[model samples]
Target: MTESLATTVRVEMVRGRARFIELRAGTFLSPRPLNVEGPFARLALVGRYATLLAGDDLRVEIDVGSGVRLELVEPSGTVAYDAQGGSASWSASVRVGVGAQLIWRAAPFVITAGADIRRHTRIELADGARALLSETIVLGRAYEDGGGPLRATMQVYSNTMPLLVEDLDLRNTAHRDLPGIIGRNRTLASVLLVGARPAKACGEHETLLAGAGALARALAPHAHEAQAAVDASWERWSELVEGRAV
Candidate 1:
């Protein structure tokens, strides 16, 4: 069966202020509003229970109405435990209306040894809409080799036109050890900014996407080391997405 626990969060502009139109808690995530002001809202995704167990299916949905801005934060990261013979899944779908914006700085997702999990993200953006998203993936915890096998995928669309499609497979250590692949790195961090392009490249890790955005990614032995470059890109790209930078 599919996941029965689907958390949803929706925001819209009302009376010249951004307001929560819908906030539903799922089995895993609870959406709680932290602050709201003119055209902007801040929310925290609080975990209600331990997650990423065998046969666990977790899903999240988000919507931002036209001209509104929503920022989502997580209190902690997630770890996928060994599934034995079963597998787990985590998926999210996002929609940004015309001129709207979404900023999500997701926490790390760790895959422990013997864990098999799949993570997917889909984003649809209307004209003039923008989004800034960050992600960190850890193969295994400290003093461990890595997880069994994990697949991460992402797809982004500008209305009906596709903007980005990516897939990362770490099912085999030999393939993952390829030079161009992750090599010996245990952590991977990425930052994506859509609907606007950065004025300059952050460094060798930055790449301007085929669409109207850019992506910054890095690999390191630890999450903190990989996050530095991605965070630097976030600083510049987030400002442009929010119209704070030129």
Candidate 2:
């Protein structure tokens, strides 16, 4: 039997506070919301198929209502195993309402040797919404040759204006060494901050010649940088919304 998982989470403002109002998970998928003392709530993923298998399909959807703040975290990394002649896929879709904020700190996604996979991320934000997101992709396991084909796509938009869009199709390890591409790097890290305008400070696309730990180190500073940008944008937007600034 082919394995599949689907999880959905929704956050909304209740009595002037953000709370998780709805959460659902399918087979082999688990979503746990941790009790952290702050305006932002943390969500952890616990599952049996964090490492996907052949013919596996996984989907995650998250929605943040107006004035809500939420953070998402993965306890561990996700690995795509060799599917022999088959393939696997994982996708996530996020929606942020007006005046909402989201911080998604994703763990590394490793493509093991001989694995064929496709990953996609789509985020839509309303006017006055802000988000800080990060992702890391590792080509293969440590001390081993790289993996098989991996096609990844990402699209971020605010209302109708496109903030960022990327479509990468990597067939094999050779593609990683190509100039202007990964350039002999096995890991690729990306951090995006979307708000009033595109956060150009966080718009850096560089390949990293390091492992997952190094990627995390590289992402930490960028995450903070992105948060700062988002905060600034929020202040500006608030001023405009309140008619204090033209």
Candidate 3:
């Protein structure tokens, strides 16, 4: 049977405190907000299909009201199972209101052998809004030689101006043999910060694969390493923002 999941989360300022105005999950998706001491609200995912199967379609939407701060986390990583000639897709759309802040530290998504998947992310930030997002993708399981095809895209905008746009397609054989494009690496990771002035650091848009601590570090790197990098990045970003605000 084909499975589908859709989740929508909305947060707004209520009397100077950020509150979840709307939180809904459909079908096989579950949203669990964490109770932690922080300036931002944190959320986690809990459900069966968190490890997606063939013919699964998952959609996630998030909205942050003006002046609210929100953080999203995926406790466990997602793995795409072998489809046996079937396919799956996952998409996320996020909108941040003026002066709102958002940080999404996503877990690694692995595509096992024989799986076929399509993933896309679209984000729109209102004037004065700020956001930091991270994503990691692994081609196959540890010690696995091959996996199915995957096409991923990301589009981010600040108000009406585009901030970042990317498209990546990887398939068996081509993904492994192509030099400068994953090469022998099976993992790819990226971090994006929007609503900030373009920096000369690495240009306005940057995509790095197999760098320090990256999956390229070893022949078959554990997914936890990638997740740790993402989490650390987010923590550093939050500290930077806090320091700036002070």
Which residues of candidate 2, in runs, are more than 4 Å off? Answer: 1-3, 36-39, 196-246
lDDT of 1 by residue, 1-246 (tens): 245679999899988899899999988889999999899999999988887888888899999999999999999999898888888999999999999999999999999987899999999999999999999999998978776688889999997688999998887755887888888899999999998887677679999987788999999999999998677898888899999997
RMSD of each: 1.2, 7.5, 4.9
For each candidate in the order shown, give its overall lDDT on alpha carbons: 0.90, 0.68, 0.70
- Please rank every candidate by lDDT, starting with the best: 1, 3, 2
Candidate 1, run of 10 with poorest lDDT? 1-10
What TM-score do all the candidates reach, one by one?
Answer: 0.97, 0.78, 0.83
lDDT of 3 at 148: 82
Question: Residues 52-136, candidate 3, lDDT per residue (tens digit)?
Answer: 6777888888998888788888878888888888888888999999888887767778889888999999989897887877777
Across 59-92, the per-residue lDDT of candidate 2 in tens digits comes to 8889999977787878887888888888888898
Candidate with better lDDT, 2 vs 3? 3
| Model 2 worst lDDT window (10 residues) | 208-217
Using alpha carbons, what is the TM-score of model 3?
A: 0.83
Under the 3 Å rule for N, CA and C atoms, how many clashes does model 2 have? 0
How far residue 232's Cα lies from its native spot in candidate 1, in Å, is: 1.2
Which has the greatest TM-score? 1
| Native-to-model Cα distance after best TM-score fit, residue 216 in candidate 1, in Å | 0.2
